[model samples]
Target chain A: DAGITQSPRYKITETGRQVTLMCHQTWSHSYMFWYRQDLGHGLRLIYYSAAADITDKGEVPDGYVVSRSKTENFPLTLESATRSQTSVYFCARRTDYGYTFGSGTRLTVV
Target chain B: GIQVEQSPPDLILQEGANSTLRCNFSDSVNNLQWFHQNPWGQLINLFYIPSGTKQNGRLSATTVATERYSLLYISSSQTTDSGVYFCAAQTGANNLFFGTGTRLTVIP
Candidate 1:
């Protein structure tokens, strides 16, 4: 309850459908990030928010969108989910020392 | 963009053995971090070494910022330690570039 948390620990969606993954951090960190981990690729950042209403694209932001309406929330949305988007997604908050990641969301686009 | 490379893509060791994982970055970084991704897919921060050494329990890390490299040491490895170890370098812009990771397997 005191750390970052991602909703829908597991999700399955059909290709071309819209899906949204939610991330909430209780600490209200100024920086929040979304990263997708794939085999052989480690973790690739998809989007990041520096503060409320300020977001930027990361290494792999092609089909994803992000919004930070509040310091405690950063949600990632797949406007049109594709099979290639199937991967384990992690939400993290930049801490004083380093970044703290959530449990991860396993998403499968069929 | 920064490039992060990790050595020993795969490793197998017996329990109680000691191991070291290496990470190299292409450019200068403001800080370096080590994380352990457990089999359950949880990324736990191990160290936040910028240019010094720090230890926690059986794990220790050292980052030579001037050299653009970092090392993570795990002593007396256990089954629980069998996971993917990743090193991430943070730039001045606060973007973290992660290494491909070193997967370790420990057998009893």
Candidate 2:
């Protein structure tokens, strides 16, 4: 319960709606990441933040937006949800020991 | 960008058996991690062996940076170990590039 957590464990939304998935960590890690997992593909990074206000794109960042206003929080937003974006999204934070990952959020677009 | 490849895409073992999973990367990396994704979609970090060897309970990992590969050994496999195992690597402080993964099934 003290590690990383993702909100809205499962969500269903329309293709044109904007949906935001939340990620929170208690370790105050310097690096946080958002990744989406799809069939036949490994976890692909959508965005990552080094610290508050410092964010950058990853391998796949077309319709996703991420902001880290606080070291303990990194929220990912799907500007306009697409059926193609339906997958299990995971949030992870890097620490001295290793990476702590959230349980993941399953998002389905109609 | 570095490419991560995992061998034995799928593995099946009997309970109490032992297995080894391998991961090969295309370039050098600063961070290497192993994760187990359960049926519930939780990615549990198993090890952070960028180099050298480390062991925890029945699980152990070795990362040979010079060889650009890593190996994970699971001793006395259990039914609870059935799931997908992934290996990820990153150069510098960049985000990790995960391998396609190895799906493991442990039968009773």
Poorest 10 consecutive residues by lDDT, candidate 2 chain A: A92-101
What are the per-residue Cα lDDT tens digits for candidate 2 across A7-50? 99999999999999999998678999999999987799889999
Report model 2's TM-score to 2 decimal places: 0.97
Interface root-mean-square deviation for each candidate?
0.9, 1.0
lDDT of 2 at B26: 90
Which residue runs does candidate 2 get wrong by more than 4 Å? none
Tell me how each candidate scores on DockQ against the true complex.
0.80, 0.86
**What lDDT does candidate 2 reach at residue B41?**
76
- Model 2 Cα RMSD, Å? 1.1
Score every model by TM-score: 0.97, 0.97
Q: Whose DockQ is greatest here?
A: 2
Scoring only the A-chain of each prediction against the true A-chain gives TM-scores of 0.97, 0.97
lDDT of 1 by residue, B11-88 (tens): 999999999999999888887899999899899998988889999999999988888899999999999999999999
